[model samples]
Target: MLEHLKKEQINPSIIEEIKKYRQKYADTADTSQTSLRYLYYGKEIWEAAVHALLCGENLLLAGSKATGKNVLAENLARAFRRPCYNLSFHINMDASSMIGNDTFRNGEVVFRPGPIYQSAVDGGFCILDEINMARNEALAVLHSVLDFRRTIHIPGYDQIPVHPATRFIATMNYGYAGTRELNEALASRFVILQMPSITQDNLTRLLLREFPGIKKQFAEQFSGLFSDIEKKCESGELTEKVLDLRGLLDALRLIQNGLSPYPALDMGLTNKTFDAYEQTLIRDIITTRISKKTESTTIFS
Candidate 1:
């Protein structure tokens, strides 16, 4: 997996650090089971993440939706050849949910470890997905673990020391609805990387990478369509729901599978917004891009 990243011309020192970590620890988890493959870390964010991780600094990827923060986190884990634990932070996740909780197992209370606890003990890379959604109070437990101290203090248990190789790559979107600002103290713990929106060329390459059978012309069209929707969202003409790369890809898949582009595009773009007026605006954008004869056409046929 790391060999494929050579084309990106990553820093030699970062490569050596990853190799050293691979040699130092036994990687217990296999990331090959997922459908998510062929990640392309263009230039900037890739170097920042690699350098930060090599420096033993925790990583915090801040960006809006569809900037590939989670994908980069997964790629880093695979590149470093380490087990990864994905812990999704929502409004309800508390400190105990992150560390561990005492549960009765056949009449005796036993500590059942959470993602953070296990990652701390076993030295795995834990991806804290949507870290901002977590209440700042709930995430305070992570302070010691992320800092130089590298320890997790459980209220009922002993202060567990983190393994040398343990790392947390957290991702959060600012200004998104239902998201909160991360406390300064927590934000200060990691090397924060502001991820940029992917370029059109990179977006096309990503589509081709994920769906090799997709025609280049259609890939360009899909990329353009996504960019258009994103612009509309940014302009407030449409809601953020339609600005989705995954949805566009899924709609392309549907088209390839014989659905009309209009319906397929609807499934992907227009249907995302619940407001009737917003859906009408979204539909107008789609119709403006895809014509009547074009609607019937699939990728190849």
Candidate 2:
């Protein structure tokens, strides 16, 4: 399945550009405090990401929101020691926004290159984050870049050959509204990896790893709450918008800050989903499972 990477090798110049971009963004990309201790589900997803990257193939990571799709993308780039350029897609995104555009400057139409073009030319790894959110026309710009024939043509500019080391990793939360089906041409060009829901054991490990002194029983309860939410989401009873474990972690942090568990949990996790009824249900779940008191005697402290 990963045959295309070895078959169509990128040029040496493109590889050099990738190295340069890596150096340029070294100060900005922070992966240091990522709790490198990720779950088993994350490991397999990351392994597939690494496999695609090493083989020099563009990757499409398709999954629901808060499923750690972007996290795995960043982790893969860090693991490969590659520089990453993230381009967030939206409904208004355009080809010119991605490739490049021509504008008058000093009475001349100067070509201002976009992130995708710049990243391709520089040989850096470009992550098309939330790709499905954009219209198909906007994503059509990437067809040539993903194919064995390496080129990105923007009108009013030269046909720029993609950098050899420049591979694209696109992520999409399929359950999100206004997202389009990835075009078949585009899909056929790159490898696709479906990310799985994080497991309870891994969530427990993550909680323990991040909040070192938290009690085992407490962590188990929290993990179980997350599992229940996952089941709710899978069954279409709840929206993916409220499924962020990171939000739950933030709520826990707020609890440690003297905020009542009710208020903290409400502010950090449940309220993020936006539906009134769902929010209420989510709050009730947290209140029942997590503590409602804000006393300083936390499970960890």
Candidate 3:
């Protein structure tokens, strides 16, 4: 991962800091997940995130759907070789659920650590996914943990200081359903990064990386198809649900398995929304880039 960072042109000093951090926390930092499934394609984003983590600042990644926010978070954790704990925020999430709660042990009550608590003590990376989905009041618990205080205060027990290698990466999708504006007090706790939409070049790089055998021409078409869907979403012609990178990858996989491009795309992208009208629009977009008779063998090496 450090070598990959070097190839991406990340700051050499930042890479060195990451290397030192890994060695410093070798005993506590979990290295079980050695590598990431997807490498985040943007060098600027990688540099910014690595610098932020090295500075010991919590990060809030604010962006639209399919912008690779979560992907970048996982990539950062893997780059630093830290054990990652993913905590998805929802309406029902609360401080107790995040930090930990008193529970019954073999004979008596005990405090069972949650993801945040475990990450704090073990020098792990805690990914707060879709952070805005929870109420502002529910998220207030993170203020001290994220800020310079760097401590988790359990009401009845002693405060646990966060390990130096522990980092929090939170993601929020703009205007997503059931999400509210994060309060200024809570938002002020971390440095925010406004994530940009995936560019055509990065999209192509992602496709080629994910499917090495896929033809470059087919990869370009798929990238074009995604861009078209994103444009429709921007124009309010379709919801963001159809602007699916994972769906496109799944479609490519199906094509690899001998499914025709159209049907594969229909199942992967068009079928994501049940609205007949929206499905028709998505199908039209797919047809513009992927031909009906395009064969699987032609798409792959």
lDDT of each: 0.82, 0.73, 0.88
Which scores better on lDDT, 1 or 3?
3
Each prediction's number of clashing residue pairs:
0, 0, 0
Winning candidate number (lDDT): 3
Global Cα lDDT for candidate 2? 0.73
Model 1, global lDDT: 0.82
Q: Model 1: which ten-residue window has the lowest total lDDT?
A: 27-36
What is the per-residue lDDT of model 1 for residues 63-142, given as tens digits with 9 covering 90 to 100? 87878899899888888777789999999999888988999999999999999999888888999999989888888889
- In order of lDDT, best first, we have 3, 1, 2
Pitting candidate 1 against candidate 3, the one with the higher TM-score is: 3
- Put down candidate 2 lDDT per residue, 1-301, tens digits, no spaces: 1121222243444445445645655554333434443433344564566667667788999987667777777655654444568899998999888887888999997888788887787666788998877887777778888888789987766788987767788998786667678778778887999888778987887788777777888889889989888888788888888888778889878766667667777787788888998988787777777766634356666
Once fitted onto the true fold, the runs of candidate 2 whose alpha carbons sit more than 4 angstroms away are 1-41, 103-109, 235-241, 272-284, 291-296
TM-score of each: 0.88, 0.77, 0.91
